[model samples]
Target: MLQSSDYDPLTAAMRPPPGETQEQREEREAAEAEALEVSNRIDAEIKASKQAMKRQKKPIRVLVLGQSMSGKTTTIKNFQMIYAQKSWAEERSSWHIVICFNLVRNVNTIADTLNEETTDSILTGRRSSLTEWHRSVLFRLSPLRRIENDLKAFLGAGSSESVEIHHPNRPNTSDGLRDSPSAQQISPPEDAKRPQEFCIWSSSGWKSILNQVKTRSAQGKESQVPRMVRAVLNSCKDDIHLLWNDPVVQSLLRAKHGRLEETPGFFLNDVDRILSTDYTPGDEDIVRARLRTTGVQEYRFTLDKGTGTSRDWVMYDVATAWIPYFPDITALIFLAPVSSFNERLMENPRINRLEDTFVLWKTVCSSKILANVQLILFMNKTDILRRKLEHGYQVKDHIPEFGGNKNEFSSVLEWFRRVFRKLFTDNNSSLNRKFIAHFTNVIDTKATQHTLQAGKFSTSRSESMALRYGCFKVQAAILRNDIEEAGLM
Candidate 1:
């Protein structure tokens, strides 16, 4: 018997039969050689896999929080355009259909407004503002409504439901907002009616939907739908223009709905260019294109920072309900459309949009789980805010707390900045946290790119400082242990 310490288990297991012939011995040797080669290959693969894992950096997780149409998606697009140029270029042409849909939907919205006004006047037996000429224009432009439906269908499954806005449960007043005196003034609309707003469920994969539309548009049999849509829009172009420009339709749109010009994805002003046969969306048009997100969306990109180092970044465009789930996020980009001071959420018409943003911001700041995460507040849509101020829309009219401050853009912007900063200081419990705010018009590509670059530099500096601080703590602990070991304490 072999001693336990000296046992050769591998050799014993590989021992051949006792009556084996020379040819059988040779076969056994060959089989053993093949097995050894296979084992070596697997070991090499495992070693390579481990090396690759070691080379890969952990993904930086970012969460983008904002209410609907707050430029969250547009901001992500900017990141893609800057860092993932190849993919952005590939998807650029696919936005043509979406841009067309936006234009068509705006026209249809105008038509619907006119119909509602006309019907209400008839029911009330009031003198109608709509003339026979207006009636004729509406009749001629009816094809756009069908085109909108077809475009929605081509967009994919959840397209029908995209017309309905789902109102989330009103923000809990207990989430830091209840303490504010202004919170009492902000209430939901008495009539909580669901309005028709175009949105896609995040689960449906909107990029894939756009790609499918592009693919089908190229195929012969499936190409007719897009062609038909183009043909209808082109034919109705003149009538669409007439109706949109008509004083009666304009008055009705203004009275029933707010300025369509102020609306997200308002392309009516570019109907002539958009309806042209060779129209391709410019960067601005694509950025401004409105598609409301109904659920959480995540995006990933590999960024090379030019120092022979690259990092993977994963960004989550999340709904309010999903905020708490990402406690370990590297950063939170909160977008508040300061321009929406006078407007209400399409989902919940009762609460002022800006006020809603305030509540959301406070809630985010007060979350203990997110206390350590870097917070970046984007006071987005400053362009729209400037326009509103220029148009004489008073900030005091919507936000009483704005007081008698000058309604000028600079004053209003400063006031918003101060308010946001106060909220941040009040709610955040982290002693090491920093407050970063940027007034951004994310749709303006050049301006947004500059801001993003500055943001990246600031974040890098902060991270470097943190790393040095951690190293200092580690060195201090080691020095203390050395002193103790030396009996010098």
Candidate 2:
């Protein structure tokens, strides 16, 4: 009984025209079919997009924490090399300038040290091991100084700042290592100061610095700075070899400055290969290269689990200013250099490096914000510790509390592990949390890759368990409410 004009306007418009010709009807039908197909395709696309959004999980967040030079950045590099191989390969060539800069810095540091020794010998009227021949060798190596400056300029302001130690708030005296007698004893002499080393900040546009190299290479107009650096290094390679091999230089480094060979980024041994005309960094070289990160660095990866599943992960390499912003992280990878028992932080020579790490660890464990966060302790630099013990560096001499323990690798490592575990157990309030530790030398890519893979698996499992536990709590609450409503409780 409804009039045709009263029907829905949209439906009425779609009806066939009155008294339409056969050709016109056929054309209209075809057009209507085409419109319907387009509409269906768009609907399919929208559905697929919604499904993809559901499948895409929230990114897994991780935070890497350590004192300066504790291999935090190196650990990140290992992750990229393993999980993000394509991007890692793309960036490998850009590390050439950084490696070259490290070599030049080493040469310059040695030259300055030798010059200081000579000047001291002259001032004190003491006989020196360095002769005129050594002086000439130093003179011949002076071009490296200019090259170093050029590389530093190219790397930007991050490489120009002095590396400083960041002191965070400590726990109360009842729970801290700051007031311990051993900590007191670890302080260096008032006059002692560490030499300045090359450092870069995360904000210094490292990617841009690297990309400049890549972009230039792609454009076939390589920068003169790189060409000049190679030229200088190639020219001075033999003198570098001679200076590093000189008995006097070795003795000075051992007796005064600690062994340069043991330090990160010691490329003097590989001078021949590194300084060759056609040198590109290998995986090991890129891993071994040292450029101290002064601020926070973030890395993202789309990791495939090989089970037709993939996950997105974001890892942060952080310095001291990490607490407030990153309390929501899924896991914290704390790196403590177990070998730093005898050394001091480069920024603050007074505080023992090991003590600093202990204080930092204590602070982290005691944080209320990170209570639910999974903690993974990496007692790193064990390889260096083993080498030190083999070289007869006594732990007892530096750490008085290490009294009477065997100076072998296992005993020393166990002793250090016990200390770190104790700190965690004593400071952490969460009883459900388990202590996880790994001895890592992050410079060894193969070994570290295996450890990191295991770490990734463990972290994922922990996250899954946490999610399940949360669900169980929510379900239990719901059941309790239902029972109360039904008067069953």
Candidate 3:
């Protein structure tokens, strides 16, 4: 090492003066010029590439879907941040091609209504099935009754302060009503301001019922039929406001004729497919499932993030809920607890009698959803293993690929590959199965957040890709490796 004695400490210089190193300076300057040229060329190439991408017009559409609380929202938001409005040049921009959907709200409402004997009690009297009563009430209830009532108030037809259903436009009537000195009286508000002419156009069916009830009363022949007729008329008059308030009914009237949309993404003929395991014949689950099975088109929305912003997203929540809506999705991301998987493997004494994980997998595979599905299973809470390992518990070697004691993470990855392959892969053909399955758990608050919260359910792109792309990449590679090993690729 050079000591202070080798150089003058007071000179504040360790190298030769500028003029003494002319040739070196020239070489350094030349190198910098070359570097500048390279940078310019690189920037030009990048600009051209961006321009090409912008000129391309086709929009990419990707659909992200899964069971509730399965990280679908997180995945879509991650994608949006990475791809939405990305720019390499001022004039070129990138658009994220992802949309996410959650069926929770719609499912919850239907599930709640059908949960007991309510539908059957009101509609069918079957005590289990949703009869016409359920359908008629749901259809007839006005969605826009509040707005329609406000409109009526504006028209002065019915209100808290006034009642003017009849024609009040006759000047004679106004003159008769108002009597005061010309100087002191406000000329009983203009008669012209009152409604001109009014007509209550009753339907033929309604009129017939009303006439029958009236005739019976006039003749003093009051009986069950007449009483029922009178009750019906009274209900119609009392609830007439509600009848005109229904959006569905109003739409029907306006269209003259049309159909409503109300289908879920999946459907099953057997009620068991939707009803919980504890469901019984008289239970609400059965009733709701029946309605869902029979109902027509339903409405569902797709949610996605706005480009480049974490605080903003577009919500496509349809205001109405109906039946038999949404098309069958192609992929499923199944999420389950890590402990649950282990319990099934160990056949834990406490939860032993419950459905085992493997059996559960088989059942899910057998569901109609699997007919065109690629499952992405999230074996979440792997962190649980660290604690379990300290207790001398071991992950059984039978499913060793799913992460045993050694290299647990890699093992988990491999286990996913093998299991997915076995379920979906075909042995005799080059066709690799279209289905994919993976596992994960939602342990963090981010995972717990609802999809609709403006700033909730956010996760880092790295975290998302760790499972999303990691699963895709490894599974795809495994398939390719198998094919090549078999001389099929």
TM-score of each: 0.81, 0.80, 0.26
What lDDT score is found at residue 19 in candidate 3? Answer: 71
Clash pairs of candidate 2? none
Best-fitting candidate, scored by lDDT: 2
The superposed Cα distance between candidate 1 and the true structure at residue 223, in angstroms, equals 4.3
Q: How do all the candidates rank in terms of TM-score, highest first?
A: 1, 2, 3
Evaluated at residue 477, the lDDT of candidate 3 is: 27
TM-score of 1: 0.81
Give a tens-digit lDDT track for model 3, residues 165-244: 11111111111101211211223333223211211222221122234434545697744432232233333332333333
Better of 1 and 3 by lDDT: 1
- Model 1 lDDT tens row, 1-489: 678999888988877889999999999999889999999999999999999999886776778788767777777766666656666677777888888888888887877777877898989999988888888888888888788777777776453222322122333222122243332355546665544665666643356666686676567446567778778888888887788888878777776665677666878889889878678888778777876646678787665432234666677888777877787677777888887777656544555678778988998898888877777777877777787789777777667787889888888888888888889888886877777666665354543333344322322333212211111112212222222232322
Candidate number with greatest TM-score? 1
lDDT of 1: 0.68
Put the candidates in lDDT order, highest first: 2, 1, 3
Local distance difference test, each candidate: 0.68, 0.69, 0.31
